[model samples]
Target: MPDGQEVHYGDYVQDDRVHKAVYADQAVYESELDNIFHKKWIYIGHESQVPNPGDYWTTWVGKERMIMSRGSDGAVHVLYNRCPHRGSLICNNEHGNAGKAFRCPYHAWQFYMDGSVRQVPMKQGYDGVIDYKDPQFSMVRAERQGNYRGFIFASLSTEGEDLETYLGQGARAAFDDICNRSPQGEAEIVANCFRIIQHSNWKIFLENQLDAVHPSITHHSTGDAAAAMQKKYKDKTGDDAPMGYQFLADFTLPFEKWDSLQTVGFPNGHTQLTGYMGLRPRDPVTLAHEAALTDAYGAERMDEILSTNVHHVIVYPCLSVQPPLQQLRAVRPLGPNKTLTEIWHFRLKGAPDGIYERALAYYYHVNSPSTMVNADDLNNFRAIQEGLAMVGGGDWVSLHRNAGQDTVDNGVTHSVTGMSEMPMRNMFAAWKQFMTEGN
Candidate 1:
């Protein structure tokens, strides 16, 4: 195809494989910003990030800058960051308290936390020329917004399924599992998050989250070193290594072990991987945490909550959640070849301090930008992106691993093998629907 030619999106997607242009083409990337990110329910910041009235945080939805603010009435609002008067950004900092109103630095135009126009300077200058009371003069809010638990999401389209329905069971379980572990049945966001810009397409990051086959191969060195430290610690001090060491050592699990696990695909591209990590060891920290939950709810209910087996959930096209680790990475596409990911971890309210420390250790050990596990994955992502952009190498990327072997029941798909590419296929299916049908 020639440059600037009108491309049919359906031609690039198939049942088993997808064309490389879907990951490399500039046109396809632009279409995605409109069809998927703008129309779908994209995750905004958590409600706890802006707990107090007039507090605000700035984030992105597709290419637009957005603000998540806490209003005086104790409701969360998602609004455009732009000032209506001169098109200036209302909040210049990433996050801060705006007191009672946001005063634009450009012309001192003020607006309330909920984006209602509050005061205008020199009102007599345009007495009958323009009505300042019109909505156009105030900052614009997202077309629709919804909250699940404490997490928030906003959609630019007026029509679509509600947030919970869009999330389906698989994605909803991610949030529920995270909150249920706390005695208070809630999770709060830790202030600030690690941000990384990867030289790869946004979809590539989502695909890698549930790839299942790459961890043992890619992070082999890191896992081996951690395992060695575990043995050395036991031999010298006669004590078991910290849980942080086990976090990395788990990456050394053989391919057969990974294949024994299961992956499930739900509607609208949501997918989940069953937990493989042994998180329920009889350590003192674990016992104390379990006791707190058991006190809040009975023993049987506490066991049910702790026994929920889930490792990771992909909230298609936007979020990669690890409910077990209390970590979430939000995807933001900068271009066809560049993507930004925000790494956030939550603290389970009313849980033992040791439990929170375990989550923090995983945050720095496995998910942090400096960790070897992420470094290995980042190298592969950039390499894959570079390979796809080249001509004459190949036209399609194979997703044939256990493709036709998946079983479907009540609109959910279960892979025959853990290494199956069903999750990738499922995401592209949703992508094709959004691109071709404009849903």
Candidate 2:
């Protein structure tokens, strides 16, 4: 509607800003689904979610419904969830076992875990007219799929860079860091997730992920309250601060401190904000966990693993990963202004129970919908959506903070300051390329 096609996206070079219409435009949303979501390698679900054969998880790649399941052969497959007959969804539930075969509830047509046709009931109805062995009757598998570690992704378009080539160096760190935390070099889903439907464009949610400037402002009240409670507890007991309280207080980190941090922009739309939460305190629980890590990985390797400083890694258009906290939120855009985010946490395999509990604490306290931290961010997202809906309000959003200060090295852009809008610019750079280029 805003002549987004005529707007040579590259021509909108601003010292520190972009047109606000990019967030609210319906045409832009459609184009994004076609170009970015369809063309890029979109994350589906972790391979571990469907560990056993016949286990499947239904998810979205843009608006398409797909089932990510483990076949009887133990290989992961992505299949369109639609039944070949009548176009009914074969898998109704979000995730469950198909038990060696998936049967369509409509006509009772059965399919194997790999989407191969297994049986068709009422065989005599069309014996001569129809061919049972035809691939058309089978559930369609995704054209391309690739896995990095145990995280699985599928591309709708057949032509593009393979998963590893597309991820480049920047996006790989998200999965690598999460896995390396464990002494055994692995992590597993904590089972189930907190699914939140947000009243905002998906991009609005992603933009906030690496947005270093907003926490101190948007979450100030929540952080301030948590900090006060922490001080009071310390005053009353003369004991150490609670980890939960400190987690919330992290939102109130000084602006300069935030500015001192770094958010890296990668080749694709992937981006990461780097800063350690100081999670490892001298408390017995922490020290014990450290000792376990030291015992398993030795002192130097253990320290390196424990000292990995990653606040958030955003695999653009879909995932926001807080690897250090074993937390990830996957964004599924449903409409121009509707997004569903699946909030999931992971346990470092073989890690201490206390460490796992720490991850769970952060999962519920900071990332869950019930938490003040999340509520505050959601409110901002909704407000931005409403503001962008205004007809006469504005044309562009500003990504100007330290805009020109970012330096690109080896194709990765590094922010001069933590609050730099480099992350937004970096994502849009990828967005423009995906949208305008056919490949």
Top model number, TM-score: 1
lDDT by residue (292-381, candidate 1, tens digit) is: 999999899999999999999999889999997899999989999999899999999999998889999899998887787999899999
Q: After superposition, how far is residue 325 of candidate 2 from its true place, in Å?
A: 0.4
Worst 10 residues of 2 by lDDT: 5-14
At residue 70, give the lDDT of candidate 2.
Answer: 90
> Relative to the true structure, how large is the alpha-carbon lDDT of every model?
0.92, 0.85
| Candidate 1 weakest lDDT stretch, 10 residues | 1-10
**TM-score, one value per model:** 0.97, 0.95
| Superposed model 1: Cα runs more than 4 Å off | 1-6
After TM-score superposition, the amount by which residue 105's alpha carbon in candidate 1 deviates from its true location, in angstroms, is: 1.1
